[model samples]
Target: MHDFPDIDYTQRFIFDESDVRGELVALERSYAEVLAKHPYPEPVAQLLGEMLAAAALLVGTLKFDGLLVLQARSLGPVSLLMVECSSEREIRGIARYDESLITPDATLQELMPDGDLTMTIDPRQGKRYQGIVGLDGVDLSACLSSYFVMSEQLPTRFWIKADGKRARGLLLQQLPAARLTDPEEREASWQHVNTLVDTLTAEELLSLNNETVLHRLFHEDAVRMFDIQPLVFRCSCSRERSANALVSLGLEDAQQLVIEHNGTVEIDCQFCNQRYLFDATDVAQLFAGGGVDTPSDTRH
Candidate 1:
């Protein structure tokens, strides 16, 4: 396959000696594509980036053929931040915030006062699962760490960073030990790995590639990493889906909208800024289970 520079890939690693695992995710194109759809402020953009990166990392550890959604909502200026990553690594995200109240330097708690972070896994065949935690920590990393510790009782640490252009994240978790026995041994191993990870700087993470970053941090250990998994920006919204949404509004409303808009009903995809157009006839065919198309779907 093609090799992309400093963007759209995840690397998972495990130390041979310790019962610990780690993941590194760098999102460049996907993050930029999401931002291109909406002009989010610096602070809101950062929050969205963190959620995007975190969603990718969380998906790495699970085995499900569905979508994983990470959402944060509160009664503050930044009301909602949501990111969705599918099993195929197709990702999309959006944020709703009061841009007028955003300051130059806004913290997560400030942006989402009384907020709750919710992670939902919607499987293709099985039942969906959701876990939620309050926004008690100072930042996204801390809050997520707390969630894992309290909810799953796993020792997990995260270091995430984002600017206007890139979002990068590192995750280290203590797994069930195979070699190390006793609580003290496991604790020591966790500390050893964490100490190495602690030295990583935000600049290096956002700039360097996966191999360089892993080596720079864990060169002394017996760390083994699998091949890179690529990520891309993709929206699940479609004309059929939009048509069904319109159909949900009942046949009368759908026809009314078409009449009000000059015999056309237009819907926009928030993730990708794609528009789907449906006229009166298309709506009739749509409810009849016939196929539909968007402006972009047609051949030039």
Candidate 2:
């Protein structure tokens, strides 16, 4: 029987002796929240959900206090797909796919034919960094693991699963600093744990609770599980920030932008599909140096 829970869960676990750690994230409502915003194709929605789950899992393991983004940029029908997750587990995501007809069994290659997977880490008080990698793998999880191996110089493995209900993933990393003298033990332990994780199926990942998943993967080993962190869907878009951006553009550029956009420069928040419209007067006020005016909230 599958041990399922009513709430989504993201938890960190560590081995007692090995320099290895793992993260398990099971998401349902949060994944649904992201998919509700746009009418994405089936493959695109699945890809975004998988990426979101992977981002949450990465956030659980990383030590940075900033936002981490997973982006897939392509020249195919699907131009771009991204998921941004903060260290605090707040996530927002969206995907752009050009195709109108997407079948249920569509693969990542079908959605993003020619694309590159990039990971960006933006700290609150440091220089932002980005790493680019080719999208040779078939799924988002594979691409993410590739990024970790290339960027962090760590041997990492990822197991990701997603469907209409929710998306989930498990991550394992063998620390780079521990490979000096006694590499055999750590590598053996990592292989032992990963071998068990390989038996996990998409249904088990999406349906099982965090503790259950951990137990299934490492029941015989000594696994120290951390407290579960709550994950939520949040879009950090506001009229004030939008207005500030307009002001930063200065007067001349703002005027040209308004004219180019037919006197109304509308910026839509991709995650939430919230549109922020700035008309000529709005642009003028922004450039006139007045405090940003509150936009009348309009909901579709």
Top candidate when judged by TM-score against the true structure:
1
- Over 54-141, each residue of candidate 2 has an lDDT whose tens digit, in order, gives 8898887778999999898987767888889998888999888776646678787776776898889999989998889887787877
Off by over 4 Å in 2: 1-7, 176-181, 256-265, 294-300
lDDT of each: 0.87, 0.81
TM-score of 1: 0.92
- Clashing residue pairs found in predicted model 2: none
lDDT string for model 1 (36-82, tens) is 99989999998899899999998998889999999899999999899
Per-prediction TM-score, please? 0.92, 0.89
The 10-residue segment of model 2 with minimum total lDDT is 291-300
Could you give me the TM-score of model 2 versus the true structure?
Answer: 0.89
